[model samples]
Target: MKQSTDLPGLIPVFPLPGALLLPRSRLPLHIFEPRYLAMLEDCLKTPHRLIGMVQPNAVPGRDESGLHKIGCAGRVTQFSETEDGRYMITLSGISRFRVQSEVDGFTAYRRCEVSWDGFDQDRAPISDTDCAFDRKVFMRLLDRYFASQDLSADWQTLEDAEDELLINSLSMLLDFSPEDKQALLEAPSLGTRRETLVTLIEYAMRGGEGDVMQ
Candidate 1:
């Protein structure tokens, strides 16, 4: 966990599509590639242990359009090494940042200068009372969507999740494309993200291809 004032101006970035990490959520990643494994080794030497998880932008004409402009930074929270030399780690989402510029570096992975502007609300505390939703309606739609993808969830657990947790978890777990996932990631707030999620689910049901809305 990093203090707001202590957030780094630059951090190593992991450019993977369909891997979204929202603030306060956890994303587990398998580090096997030589570059990312090296990235983990370097990150472990730093106290903050922060990594920027950004998705490659499929859209064109943006400066350095290889990656999205916005992404969330996460702190290494759990880690273990396998006998096969693979590293498994979990990242706890810290904050969202805008890419100011990509740093030219000798390291195997990419790094970026980021600005933590307009996302101060990510660090705010979330309470159970803040997580209200129309589950009856959502669950019904989810049931149909899940069946189409041959998936299922512990409805009881989902029903018990905090509003932020529910939305963020589903956003990360759903099998939407990079474009759809980016929409959820760039949502201005929780309420707006929820609306986007519902709209995506509705879109998927209407023939947009995607897996379960996990």
Candidate 2:
């Protein structure tokens, strides 16, 4: 697949807590709200069907209260419209971006001016050989974490996945809190992310009482 690094200055954003989209990963979304439905329509008409997946600040209030500074840009790779005017879409992760400013837009959905310079590496693939990640340790921690959460998965698939895919997929699928997900999304490198994931798993196993996962 071609990497999507040519991001626009302003892009529509979906602020969902505890949801994550990482470079080279895929995020499946169901657009039921009217504003998000409209966002989906507008994205389909564009040459680059892109959307920014961000996390809303933990503060309580309206949905648009606040958002984290960092997020991942994803391309709408699969889409379907339901008779009820809802949309089901799958986004293929492109790159990570930092919000520079929030743009005033007429659309009910929000838009942000973003910068992708710091995450330029997200556009390129990193070989597992370049990192000193202990997959066995990660998997062992994951096993205990899953048991505590009462979740199960195909172990074989996870064992065979590439390092990047394995780490990112776990980051997205795990039932971590919003803050934990954001930390994974903001980790500086794949190796760092792997370390973060292991730490998060251990924390969860200890019943959420430990040092910060970062």
Which candidate tops lDDT? 1
Measured over all alpha carbons after superposition, the RMSD of each candidate to the real structure, in angstroms, is 3.3, 2.7
- Write the residue-wise lDDT of candidate 1 on 180-202 in tens digits: 88888998888788888998888
lDDT of each: 0.86, 0.85
TM-scores for every candidate against the unseen true structure? 0.90, 0.90
* C-alpha lDDT (0 to 100) for residue 50 of candidate 2: 87
Task: Give one digit per residue, the lDDT tens place, for model 2 in 71-136.
Answer: 998999998988987888899998889998888869999999998887767887653222688888
